[model samples]
Target: MIIIKQYVSIFEPMKKIVVLLIFLAPVLSAQNYTIGNWYDFKKGAISLTFDDGHPSHYNTAIPEMNTRGLVGTFYVNFLWNNSWAIEANDVGHEIANHTKSHDSLSYLSVGELHDEVTAFNQKLENDLGFPIRTFCYPYGNGGESDSVMFYIQDTVAQTHLAARSIAKATDDEHYKYDFALSERDYYQIRTVHMRDSMRSYHEDFRKVISTGGYMTYMFHTIGTPGGWDNMEVDHFTDVLDDLLLIKDTVWIATFRDAICYHRERKTANLTTVYAPFENGNNWVLNLTDSLRDDWFNHPLSIKLEKPTEVVTILSAKQGGIELEYTIVNDSIVFNAIPDNGHIIFDILNCEIPIVDLTVLDETIICTPDSVRLEVNYDSAYSYSWFKDSVKLEADSNVFFAKDSGNYFSEVKLNGCPINTASVGVSISGVCGVPNANFESDVTRQFKDEVITFTSSSTNLQGTETYYWDFGEGSSIEPGYYGPGPMEVSYSTPGEKDVKLTVTGSVSFTDTIKNKIVEIDDFNSCGIYKEDFNGPDFKFWHWCTCKYGYNYTMEFVNKALRLNLTDSIYGEWDNFKLFFYEDSVMKPFDFSDDLYKPVLRVRAKASDTCRASFSLLDTNWVSTAGMKMNQIGYIDLTTKYQEFELDFSNLFFYEWENKVVDSTAVWGIS
Candidate 1:
């Protein structure tokens, strides 16, 4: 009885296998198991995966992926052995959640579900310093609900990453079904497990290898697992060896890659041909559905009128395959590949030419400046511009209009209409009037330097009123004027706030203010530190006696002196010195040194603000052992409300400084 029971247990699985094979025989013979026609073709293409996060993978996969040579997503779960899996340096492999417990995700609650996937991703990012975009449900049992899948699709669409499920080719078809859930309408990809002894397995794999289609296999544990149906390591290696032997002929690729390639290669064509009306010589062949394959063996055919010369069928799929033929007067003969699969062909003869016309301007926002209209057409001999269908006498590519309205154009060839396009023009008043205000240094011993304010408008057609609010509680500037240039002036020591409100037939306001700080005493301020350090190197210094509370010092390089001065009160805007050189500044703006100096100052009585300097060095330069300058600062606010500064010789001195280098200089204050 015991022996019989064991035999029965073993026989049951065999029976199931036999049944499955019987069902697959007809389908396989018919070659109807193609990706798209019978199944979502994308799902049939390939599987993407990653192996154990071994050190070698980090050194190899990361750099290779960064170069776009390969892309393989990794499943990291083991905490001890796979700790390096989330290393900060790995670049290419997509670190995915493999669950904390490695338990079946289908059984977890929503919260637990979130923790398992989300937490793992967060942890990976926190540890690796790179985001994990793709995920593989732990244990191949991430039973995400349809609603959840929809949410994922929508969210992933907005992100640079996506999540996928693991499926087996032998799994029940229903479980593997790819359907439209939420906004995502794609099938879950299936993965093939590779284990030990792949070498021998290839012997059996040959039967399904050469179908001009995809043959995917899965393996787990190269050698047999202690339990269940597992193959030996030798067998797994054998399978891999066999695949390598035929690798030249087979496209072994990740599932995602395969699907993308197939989608791009699937050929379909739609054409409109023009034939002579009198002789019916112009034939229009519409090959809209010409190469749809539901299965590998599906046959496709195309029909055309018998002709004397071979007619070439040009299509996205043809790759320029020309058909040279003997065309008998009224018909053309051509042959299509028998394995082209299910296809739809439409052959028609027409007398008129097909033209597609489109307008270049979809949306136009009119400013006070001129508006340009462009017309595009498939095949037109000459184009005529028109306003309300009335032809306009304009030959230039652009039409200048002072007003706004609807405009259209027509293209004609040999007195025949070719195409027409139209555009709507909307004209509005200038956006707003420019605000003019003045600023000056009030505390200076000399006459206060006053800056004048000027305002202007684009188009002078409308009446306009201007209102200004000076910072010293002064009355608003009251006046009205037409569009053009305007100016204002100020002669006070304090910071001023100016607001300009413009009111016209159409109302809009433009506000401008002089963010100027007047320095009455230069003796009271003292700068303790200054430095510069980026692609280029330069430095500046101010004598302790020349330091004043409200005074400004200019770093005099080539010609441009970077002005270091106090900003608005209550704002942490202190003077910042830049180190990088502006190579182009001299040619255009006329500045001194290409590099700007760095600046450092105290924030308050006790605390100090420290700013680090950086240079934007190219990877090649850095790899060549280039270094950057280091600047130091000393806060003297406690004793004299000043700071001390020093510069280090860390900047790259070997690279010759070129005025045309055109690098940028920026400072953090």
Candidate 2:
């Protein structure tokens, strides 16, 4: 509120007052509403919403909406992953909650309802930083009783501002924007189901437009045709085309925006005061509303008519914040979430124009099948086509678009340039890639085998992006947006679900499937560690010293167990198991010459055991080789654990005549 104390002197000139009016005239969007007239007094509003968090909804529906410069709401669920919904939220679309488990709420108690409704709201808010106001009913099955429905709204989903349910029957032909609301009417709002045939949706939309009502649409699975509520991308785009045509007349908003605007306008008041000050006139715009701050804080759009020839505004400010405004014909339109506070501004000196652009997207991929250019339907405006900045000879309404070039249409109204919308037409890239398809060369390969994958999909147009996952824990070309076969290998033996995900820019669709494939692990050599599967130590040797102690070694159940029983402890109470420890019997040397550690031997004992795995090799410091011993200690009285001894930690030693240690070579333990 601006309070002015004026003391105008009789000597003040009229020229000074006229100059003062010129200063304050430019900053005004000078129009006020007779309260509760929403969106230039449009008949109704419409919001495009999608559910189930499908991949195509983000990759397909969002890009299609962005082409028309419209945003939507996604009732996000953990269909694939939370990250996908978070990505859609980051793209400036509303992300709403749809519960953790998409289950029927037929017999859920109050506590279970919280788990389904309130808890889901908190989950989405925590993950995406998106406040959950709108929710979609899981399967829309709360039709049991009116009292139960009221219980859900008043108690269970009390946190949500409103909830949407599937009302295909009631909303198909008899849909209306209910201006009147009970306590639970908003929470139990119904939405028209959108599927393959959008004729019903379009009809209801027209009905809403003709009758001054609202049409709320719900869709799922954009490219997956014939699936549950399958709305194909092309069929969906057909509706978006007509919506863009009527974008100016209709208020295309998210459900939250529409509901908030309805509540805010019912109590909003815009007041302007004009009075004489000491030297100039004071024009202050005071905005006040009765909505609470917690629930209703969204900005309301204000359309202000240009008061004078000072129409070209340089700046407009309120509460010290520079307001976002636009020029449409002779009006300076801006927005403000009112708070009974006064805003002060002055006329800005800048030129602006009013362009009624109806084109959704200019860039078109030229196909042998079809293409068309948007000519101005209004004969009042002159339209001309251009290719690469060169004017075409054709000035007709229907210009068939062909060839590849940067094309644009210049629209002139009343002999003045209004818009110059351009379209970049290209003859490259795929057009209709609805599903991702791929194949691998072989299902099962050895550990060292390199598996190959290739694409075999229909409706592939131009350039493509490819992702390949070899299910044995190897991935190739991640986040790669192109076409190529992927090759990778696995180390262990297991079955694999090799998946390939490919998405095309022309049509955003993905194929996520597991191609049957298997892999084999590395074949083990019985030198250091093995499940013993041969004759028991035949080629080997064992020595047992008798001092009231005896030892017996045998292969039992694919395992090697050396049992010992000692009645008395003596100096010779020892047993050594060796692999032919003689001069001619040299230990096995790894052919790859690769240094490997961790000797694993599964063993069980009858008594407390102490044994040493001795290796006599020539790779030691001496030419004749030194004896390197790795100790194994276990007392597996009931159970056995695999003993893993790392040979890399062995001490390096060389001997001269088995006496003095010389220069240390590579240790063999």
- Candidate maximizing lDDT: 2
TM per candidate: 0.30, 0.45
lDDT per residue, candidate 1, 1-669, as tens digits?
A: 111121121112111121112232232111111223212222222233553343434554344434433444555664443334544225333455555666666566667766666666677666655655445555555424455444333332222123455554443332232322322323244445554423434533443333334434543222335622255544534444455565544544543334333332343232333232322423333332222132111212233453223132222222234434333344433433332322222222312223343444423343565555655434534666777667789743455544566676555445444334466666544544433443332322111333344444333334555555444522325445322233333344445554445554434555443343332322222342223432433333322212313333344333222222332232222333333334222211212233333323332221333322232322114335533332343332322222323222223222444222222232323
Q: State the lDDT of candidate 2 residue by residue for 1-669, as single tens digits.
A: 333344332222200121122343443333543433456556678888888777788789988988788878888765434555656666667777677687777668768878887887787777665677777777876622276566665543356555677765363344455533543555566677888865755566676677566667889888895668898777899989878877777788777777777767765777564321312333457666654455566777777665554534545667778777777777666777767356555552333334333334334443553346666566676777788989997765445566677666666556554345566666533455535777778776555557877777544555556766655466443456344566777766788776677766654766564587787552211122235443223233243333333233333323333222221332223334433223243333322113333344433232444433332323354456454443433443323344554443333242554533221112111
Cα error, residue 283 of model 1, in Å, equals: 16
**Best by TM-score, which number?**
2
Error of 1 at 312 (Å): 17
Candidate 1 residue 643 Cα shift, in angstroms, is: 20
